[model samples]
Target: MNKTIFITGTSSGIGQATAQYFEAQEWNVIATMRSPEKQNILKNSERMLVLKLDVEKPETFNEVIEKAIAHFGKIDVLLNNAGYGQHGLFEATTSEQIHRQFSVNLFGTMEITRALLPHFRAQKNGSIITITSGVGRVTVPLVSIYAASKFALEGFCESLSFELASQNIQVKIIEPGNIATNFEQTTKSNFAADEALTDYSDYLKKMDEVFKGIYSGGGSTAADVAATIFKAANDESNVLRYVVGSDLQPLIDIRNGGTDEQYMDVLRSTFVPEN
Candidate 1:
């Protein structure tokens, strides 16, 4: 029997690419997004079922998961791919934005995984893959809150990996440095700003340039990440983290290979150079 992979955030970017990649590889795919009515790109796709799934809405999760399983027989993998980064100075960001950021990025992943745990536990076999970012393991200016969410997710998966290991359930996280996708554009366009704080205006403008050079200077494509996810899904290893994006790898190395102070200095020199 063909394996089924249920994925969230399939409307665009890495999620869309991964759904396509898996379908081409002959796997059953549950390609879910917030607004399924607005998509037709995968309308005629064979062996792929596109559905509505807004991760922020936990109330709707169980229904979607049940529908996916009923349609595909059984799901072998769960790809937590639906999330957005809330970008801005911490003070500039509102509580609502922070709640929404974590709601989808961290909480949504947790809730969905919780809903699926019973199914996987009973089978005693499964893979849970989450797409976090390179910043999850490090940090950068202008994205403090975004980094926090990913960081929480990283820790969550790391701990859950051990709990699920005995049952043959693999918990994996994909950390991409930066990617050439509309993901960045969407993040920037929707960034929250507190206009009342004019004092930080100049700093914000400068950080914009810093973010561009650091995040978009060079990175991987959504397809590259999709390929990496495929490899991780099939590897059946006890390993937990898989890093993608060539541009982000070196920074991860800096974090992995040195002391916290040294890594902070490197970031400071790179983004906050003293004048």
Candidate 2:
């Protein structure tokens, strides 16, 4: 049987790469994005059904779910890959920015997963994979809001996996270190301000430089993450999480073994101090 996957945020970056990987492996992929008209790769793929999906809009979930079922008959996997980063000082970040982060990354994803639960329960088999981040486990300076949203996803998905154990619905989370993609460029920092707040502007610039270095140098590839997602989707035994990146394994191990301070030290060591 040809397994079907509904992936969000397929217009670019990791989501786009993952969609292409799955389709190439002969899976029926419902590649969704906020703008279907902008998706050349998805539009060109015979195995892909490109649809418009804005994760912040909960009302769009049912419509996309209906369309996906109509196109693929059944959804074997739900890849919740749609989210943006909110990077800046917590004091500078507005309530609106916080709300938008949670809306798209946490609440909206929960709504879609909830809607799909009945279908998974009926079929008695399904898999869910979410693209969380290394920040979910260890905090980094200037990205607390984004980290909080992913942290929530990690908790929610882990708990849901235990709840769904008997029902055969497997939930897995992929924690990828910064990757070389447009993902970093798309990050929005709430630190834009005039002379009154110019003191903090340098902080934003420094952080942006740090992000650029991370993505351009030490980060893993999107293709690597796509392969991990494919494994979690097809494997029969349920694995709760898969961490991607060369350095991620040691960090995860340290986090698992030692105190919070020990884990945070690893993060601090990576800090590129402003010159």
Candidate 3:
């Protein structure tokens, strides 16, 4: 029987690329997004099934999962890719933005995976792949809420991997550095900030300049991330985290090589200016 992978946030970027990759590999692909009506690129693909799934809406998860399984007979993998960035200073972020950030990234990812656990346990086999960010490990300025959510996911999946191992289910996290995606625009749209707070004016200016440099520097392509996720999905071993993009490896090493204070010093030197 052909394997089936259910991926969320497939409207664009790595999610869409992975759906295409698996479909080409002759796997049944459930490519879901907030609006299935907007996805025209992969609808016609031979083994692809585009569905609607908004991670923010926990009420809709069971229905989507049921439809995916009814169509494919079973789900071999679940890719938690439906998430966005909410960037700005911690003080500038509103209560609503904070809730929404965790709601979509951390809470929703958990909810959807819970909805699928019963089925995976019944089948006694499955893999769960989540697209977390490198910011989950090495945090920078202007993305506090975004980084928090990703960091939570990294911890969540690492622990979940151990629990799911007993049931013959594998849990994995994909941490990719800044990829070439429409996410920059999405981040702008999702942002909340108090422009009138001049206390951090110079700090904000420097942060903006640093972010522009990072985005422009170009770390990884969406295809690169997709390929990494593919490798993780196919991996039968119990490995839990797959860091994508060559540029992120050195940073990951630095973060894992030393104590928390050491990583803090490194982060401060990179993003904080000397006065």
Candidate 4:
């Protein structure tokens, strides 16, 4: 029997690619987005069932999960791939933005995973894959809040993997570097600041420039990330995390091999000093 995978944020990017990849392999793909009424390529596929799912709305999980199980009979995988980036200096970010970012990225993912845990526990075998980022492992300028939320996920998934081991539930996180996606264009900027932060405008501008270059096909493709997620989902060994993209490999090597001083030097060299 073909396995069923429930993926969030399927309107585009890695989620969409993952949906296509699995469908090509004859697996049932439940691709979800906040608005299913929107025209999408996945909507036309016989193997794909595009559902409505807003991660922030925890109330929708039960109904959505029921629909998924009914459509595919059983869900072998749950991909928590829905999230957005909030770019701004820590000081410039409002409380609302911080809460919103965490809500959608961290808490929302957690809620959905929690809701599905019982089903996975009952089945005694399942995969929970989350789309985290390299920033989760290392900090970056102007993305402190976004990094924090992913960092929270990394820690949560790591611990959850251990806890769910007895039930044969696999918890994996995909930490990819910048990937080519509409994520940058969809990113909400909250950099509005008063006169006191005028000195940091150039640094913020530089960060925006980097995002444009990184997300516009200059970095890894969405398929690259989807492949990583598929590997983590299908792998027999209980690996905790999979880092995707060549751009991230060097940084991971540095993090794993470099000394403290080297790490600090690299950070300083890459990020412009805030004057």
Candidate 5:
């Protein structure tokens, strides 16, 4: 029997790429998105099933999961990739934004995993792969809420891995650095700002420059993330974390090896140098 992987946020970016990658590898893919009608790509493939799934709404999960199972028999993997970045100063971020960030990035992922646990446990074999961020492991400027959500997800997955081990369910996290995708465009639109509080305008500008520098340097592509996710799903080893993007490894190493003060200084000097 061929393996089936149910992936969320498959409308575009890494999700879409992953769906394509898996289908090319002869795996059944349940590719889900918020607006399935608007999706033109990833259609007509016999092994691919594109469906509507809004991660923020838990009520929709049962129907989606049931349909996926009915179509593919049994899902061997669940890829939680449905999330957006909430970028801006923490002070400028509103309560609603914070809630929205957590709801999608953290709560939604957890709920989906919770709903699938019984099935996975019964099967005595499964893999839960989440697309976290480098920011989840190391902090950066101007995306505090987004980082918080990813951080929460990292902790949640790490803790849940221990509990799920007895059932033979593997929980894995993929931490990717800045990738060339529609993410930056979405983040720009979703970013919260307060013009009245112009005191932080200079800081925001500097952060923008830092972001521009990173993008201009040419980071990893969404396809690279898709490949990494594929490896995480298939690897039978006891590895828990797979860090994608060559640009992110150094920072992760620094965070692991350096003290808190040293890390802070590194971030400050790298992204917020004094003029």
Candidate 6:
């Protein structure tokens, strides 16, 4: 029997690529997104099922999962990739923005995984892979809320891996650096900016410069991240974290090697030199 994978946020970027890659590999793919009608490519494959799934809405999870299982017989893996970045200064972010950020990035993933746990436990084998960011391991300016949400997810998955190991289920996190996608546009759209708040304007300008530098240096593509996700899903080892993109390795090493204060100092000097 062909293995089946259920992926969220399949409308574009890493999620869409992962769905296509797995489908090409002859695996059954439940490619879900908020608006499946807008997607045209994946539906061409008989093995691929495009469904509607708004990760921020927990009420819709059970129906989506049930439909997937009914269509594919069983789900061997769950890929949580349906999150958007909420970028801005922490003080500038409204309560609603913070809630929505955590809701989609952290809570939604948790709810979907929780919903699938019973099925995985009964089968005694499964993989849960989440698309976390490099910021999850090391934070930078302007993306405080986004980083916090990913950080929470990273910690959640790491600890959950231990509890789920006994059941032969694996929990893995894919930490990718900047990927070439509309992610930048999406982040900008969600960014909370206040022109009247002149106190932060200069700092925000420097932050934007730092972000531009990172992107200009170039990073991995969404396809590369998809490949990493595929590897994590298929590998039978107990590995819990997979870091993608070469650009992120140095930052990860710096964080791992230094204390919190040292890491903060490094970021300040690099991104906010005047501060």
Give one digit per residue, the lDDT tens place, for model 6 in 1-275.
Answer: 99999999999999999998999889999999998888777683679988889988888889989999999899999999999999987888899999999999999999999999999999989999999999998888888899999999999999999999999999988999978999999888878887678898777777778778888988898899989999999999888888888888988888889898888888878877665
Q: Which parts of model 5 have CA positions greater than 4 angstroms off?
A: none
lDDT of each: 0.89, 0.84, 0.88, 0.85, 0.92, 0.90
Residue lDDT tens for model 3, 83-136: 989998788899999999999899989999999999999999999999999999
Model 6, TM vs. native: 0.96
lDDT comparing candidate 1 with the true structure? 0.89
Across 47-74, the per-residue lDDT of candidate 1 in tens digits comes to: 8999998888889988998998888888
Q: Per-prediction RMSD in angstroms?
A: 1.4, 2.4, 1.3, 2.1, 1.0, 1.3
Which pairs clash in the backbone of model 1? none
Scored against the true structure, residue 127 in model 1 reaches a CA lDDT of 97
> Where in model 2 is the C-alpha error above 4 Å?
188-195, 198-213, 269-275
lDDT of 2 by residue, 1-275 (tens): 69999998898889999998999899999988888886577674567888888887778788888988987799999999999898867777788888888999999789888988898999998998898999898677788889999999999999999998889889999999868787765774344234566777776677767767765666788899999999989887767889898756777788899988877776676664636
- Candidate 2: RMSD over Cα atoms? 2.4
Give Cα distance to truth, residue 98, candidate 2, Å: 0.8
Relative to the unseen true structure, what is the C-alpha lDDT of residue 211 in candidate 6, on a scale of 0 to 100? 79
lDDT of 4 by residue, 1-116 (tens): 88989999888888889999988878889998998788447874667888999999999899999988987788999999999888766787789989999999999999999999
Runs in model 3 with CA error above 4 Å?
Answer: none
**Residue ranges of candidate 1 with Cα displaced over 4 Å:** none
Best by TM-score: 5
**Can you give the lDDT of residue 169 in candidate 4?**
90
lDDT of 4: 0.85
Candidate 5's residue-wise lDDT over 1-275, tens digit each?
Answer: 99999999999999999999999999999999999899789894679998899999999899999999999999999999999999987888999999999999999999999989988988999999999999999888888999999999999999999999999999999999989999999999978898888988888888788788888998999999999999999999999999988889998888889798888888889777687
